[model samples]
Target: MFRATETFATHAVANQPEPADPPDPWADDPALRGRLAAQGGDAQTPAALGAAIRDGDAWALGEAARRHPPELRLWDRAGRRLDEVAFHPAWHALMAMGLEAGYAARPWDGRPGGHVAHAAMVYLLTQAEPGVCCPMTMTYAAVPALRADPALAALWVPRLTAAAYDPALAPVAEKRAATMGMAMTEKQGGSDVRANTTRAERDGEDWRLTGHKWFCSAPMSDGFLTLAQAPGGLTCFVVPRWLPDGTRNAIRLQRLKDKCGNRANASAEIEYERAWAQRLGEEGQGVRTILGMVHHTRLDTAMAPAGLMRAALREALWWCEGRRAFGRRLIDQPLMRRVLADLCLDWEGALALGLRVAAAFDRGEQAFARIGVALAKFLANKRCMTVMAEAMEALGGMGYVEDTPMPMLYREAPLNGIWEGSGNVIVLDVLRTLSRVPEAREALEAEWDAGAGDPPYDAALAAFRDRWPGPPDEGDARLWAAQAAALLTASVLARTAPAPVAEGYARARLADCPPVPGALTGLAEGAILARLGGAGPAGESE
Candidate 1:
């Protein structure tokens, strides 16, 4: 909720508008001139730099930024209407800089990474210019290996990165994103990797992938990172945008997905025809590599919603304080203040959860990787939708109106949860991860003997067993419901375990904390048992 004092007029104080100064010719500001000289921009004219897009190097991208500038673009469609067109054009300019800067090289490429390359990608994403950023990030993620095979990466990086400005490419293809990356998705096999129906067969030295993928984000990208079933195991491959001789491959664009958000970037259904592909990683390692990418993407998805919420709330708060209703400021109303507070609290939770997951990933923690990723995506995305809704309500009709940005963000935020992996899929993955932990099972049993460890979790485990006296049927919805419920209960329990009593006043303070609930404990126990029995709720068992 927002109080009048806390509203934009007060907060707007933090957003002071500065007087525009005449463009500096080159006096000597270290921050500006220093960075420029360091980057070899000291003696160059902005025009001279704009002309350098032909090389698509970092310096050229900087020059492009000086020339083109940046802004956000929101959209409405032919049959279905989108909420708003939102993006910062500067992000696009930065991506062009990335391409020009040659930052699209392989992961292992010797190019220096600092503020420039990273700023380029961050600007695109934060500003909703993922057309260029998504493709570049995907390509960059695989660059270590791509660089190892320079012929392949070298041939495509330039084409993909250069899409932002190429005249012919932008008309039919994604001039902003280029043709370097393709999305991998399936109707039947989103999280259930084993359910993939796409097949790849060997043809002499070449392999062909055949399947239909839904929501290929950048269909115009020169190649798609595809998943297919191999004789030996599940495999991942990169199918080129065109044939060996540079002809269009046998890929049919079924239809562009009229998505709820992120419309600036292409999301289309695609059909493959014996599409030639080169294997990435080993046959059985497809799931591993794909999951690795999914982890990062999940973080990206989480961050997008959080950022959107921040921007939306800021807009709403500004409006509340600045606008008037009933001859008084909206923020003066206690209810509005509460709403604003709730919005901030939601934002904090989502931000904390997303940052925690991202930090874990940054540290390369593989043990709880899946669980952390799912949790972050699950919580952050859900919070984004919640906050957006709250913002919209707080704004009343204005929130829904297109002129204001809140509705656009509210409409677009839900897509994040559904796209990366539906909420259900992510919850299931968390359950699966927890179920597989031997220590988790051991802890459940040990809690009973200790009579003091995470009792709610232990009780939840017991209750689950009481409900299901025998092993579960794979198809039983109760089994999955129980599993997810148990995971949540257990997660809370693990997080809230009572600290050991200290010797004095500290010990007494610890003792005052409530004991863990029994129902949650029983739930954990039953889920562990079911998991240890080489099974899970229906549709997930081996």
Candidate 2:
């Protein structure tokens, strides 16, 4: 109970959602409700996935961890057997799901859906698979605007989309917990889009690309999304892996990075000269298209740390409940209980926050989506690492042992923080959003207001201004920046609203109260609880 007490301490202090209507526990949280609604009609996908994950029908999630565990033990043991397996079942299901639920079903339905379909595919694979290679193929899909170009879409989107599920074109490299794709990282520029010296010049009726890609995951991919510089600017093109003669393209493998994880996926650094390629979008638009894919890809990368953390926490709880210490179950010990409680509360906060970002995408709020995704990914990844370490500590030596799953989870969580974008990069993104986007900042403020019971805007504005006295000549940007900072600061304050009382209890072991640490942490410092008489287990416990 000491551990649970300590854990609950954090949760109690952070804050909780306000009192809500009887039917909807999430009613006070528009963000949560909106997100739950956005991921199709059901927010049960994760739960459902958990239920049937082991089944062949469940897609690659279960197999994903199986594909790459703490060590490459399984792959090294049965690499050939796994590779022979068909295209990742997850990709198939995801593409189908995107077409059904994730499709951008708005004004620009077709193009957006294609983008989404591609995004969903990339997201699942990066989150699920292990390897040092790229997460998505940088598939022609990565060049969506190019793929969907009026001229290119007519020729490419259909062909590439169809080829996506083509088993012949899609090959799985056993299980290495790395990003898998066709092209490899160049020795000179891995992610530096501008530094790519690959050249794709127009040749009669054909565009020929010549350059070296150093970190190709599946160099054997039917085609590679290659970046090259043209006279106008850098451009992206899709180059076939093989020619009509059924021989590999003029692609020469340099070497594969001896990476730490995702070893099962083959990553080859390769050089291609006079490679037959097709330009997707107009020259110089490569960066835009690639960056667009990146915007969506970040969502996928974000899922990885969260998923890893989820798995680790589940393991910790299971161990705590069953493991015995000093004649009592670990969970029965007050200190152990505190740890578990705090872990769970933090987990819930991270989950809700990440889902909120996902909801932004579902809501067609791209700008919000970008900021939310960055924030969620950054925070979740950071938390997961900390959680994994704490979970390990809670278990003592057993946690560090390879026999336990915690170590692997511990290793994986940090990787997601670095992937897609680093933590620092993400924080900068948050700062940039605060600096540039007034509308988003304002909308965020409205969110804070609704949760805490709105303060008079005029009064609040005056109060806000008074708190920050500074020079006038710094202009509107500076003033608004201050306002944005204040608004964000206020949002944090509003996280905990109406406090839970004995009379308001609703359920056993759970109250209609906030369970996440962030939900009540702030209030825990000084709030008083009233033990008003009430009915039910919720009140009875208090």
Candidate 3:
């Protein structure tokens, strides 16, 4: 006692930022609140869910889940086939919270603004944990695709929509609730579903699927909406994990993919050895049927990036506010302020654009929703990488350290862009949509026209039309898509965001501002930064 305590002095921690406790994601996020209200979504559910995530141990749970990735248990110790994936308790806890809060059920709950509310949930849940989003999104998206078969929809929609989480290894009928996954891509054909070779044979009332799925995400779901070649070309089917007799299905888990990210959720390569399946839609209509699911999932993919950007920026801002350098708070430094403020434009534009597309979904504007979501997904996801990188840099060394959430956010940033559709796929789809669906182009133009007063936006719109005239050559497709998406984002911001914020985006993005973050000249720094903490004219805390 005389020697050790006195001789060894431990330095006290100084000028370190305390952990940013989870704010009410619903209440603190004025952009989310404002957009939800503007889009006519019911704020009651989102508010409640946000509070639950904030007040509960969601952050800790998220961290624990990320730390402990899911493990594949293909067989039991007794040498029997199990085909189960084991997740940490934290994963199940987060999944339970999401399902209980209607993450998968809201849109089909017969409520107004169902889609909008569902989109909001996607944004909110993504902030807490991005990995768990894969299964829930598939579950949410499956409802519409399943509706292609009224019988299948009737049997499965209730379980899919039930506000409960049942992780039992049992038949769907035996569980109180169920989650859904999708297995569409084969090794030979990733985005080209028409090139699928998985064969489905008639086995009485049900079909038997026999092929390999290269990527099967959330492998433990109760059922999966899969695509296979049937007697009449490719078709969609519902493949259950367990047979009605409480026996395992013929689906074989080859192995889990060693993915670079989304560690908490399991993605697998599997073989469908005559797995029992029910035909979901008419044979040969697989692409058309599955497009329904793909479309909805794209909406989530679009919104998730917005949530990730928000989460990263919040961390950076907190660090700047509490940490000091050169005898001044980091937030008080002019250069730091410029960087953070410029970053805000991206996060704000992304949130606004994504929600606007969501609102289109809510209003049943299929023409606009189709094109709008693609634009939002493409633009927001691209901006997400930039925002995440800049925000990480703002935190200096701590951002790169695993001790903080930045690395996780950085890892997740590229996933949404790759999922649903990669960048090239999205751009080609936009061209296809605009070419085949004239109404989509008209709707898009109408949307842009609504924000015509901004000079920069107006000039950008004019230049886009003149440059394209009739869908620029495929070589220029990406450039066209990027310009169109940026203009669309600026248009949406003009109508929905505060004047200064909208003007800043138009000047920085639509005009001649450099592509890099913080390379801006005339951004209203005060107005944009004020929105970060939910305290500006347009972003008043609810």
Q: Give the number of the best model, judged by lDDT.
A: 3
Each candidate structure's count of clashing pairs:
59, 45, 0
Q: Write the per-residue lDDT of candidate 3 for residues 1-542, one digit (tens) a residue.
A: 13222233677567888655568888889888887777788887778789888877687889999888899888889999988899999999999888899989888888888888888888998998999989999999998899999888888999999988999889998888999999999989899888889999999988999999999999999999999998888899999999999999999999999887788889999999989999988898988998999999999999999999999999999999999999999999999998998888988888888888888887889999999999899888888999999999999988999998899999999999999999888888988998899999899889888889988889988987886777766656666777787888888888888888999999888875225333344566667877687465564443
Instruction: Please give the CA lDDT of all the candidate structures.
Output: 0.51, 0.48, 0.88
> How many clashes does the backbone of model 1 have?
59
Displacement of residue 20 (Cα, Å) in model 1 is 14
Off by over 4 Å in 2: 1-51, 57-143, 146-148, 154-165, 169-185, 189-191, 217-220, 243-247, 429-440, 447-450, 453-542
Candidates sorted on TM-score, descending: 3, 2, 1
* Deviating ranges (above 4 Å) for candidate 3: 1-10, 513-542
User: Candidates sorted by lDDT, descending order?
Assistant: 3, 1, 2
Best by TM-score: 3
lDDT (Cα, tens digit) per residue for candidate 2, span 378-471: 6566667777798888768878986665665566667767765575555566666656775655556555454343343334544544654432
TM-scores, each model vs. reference: 0.60, 0.63, 0.92
Model 3, residue 346: C-alpha shift (Å): 1.0
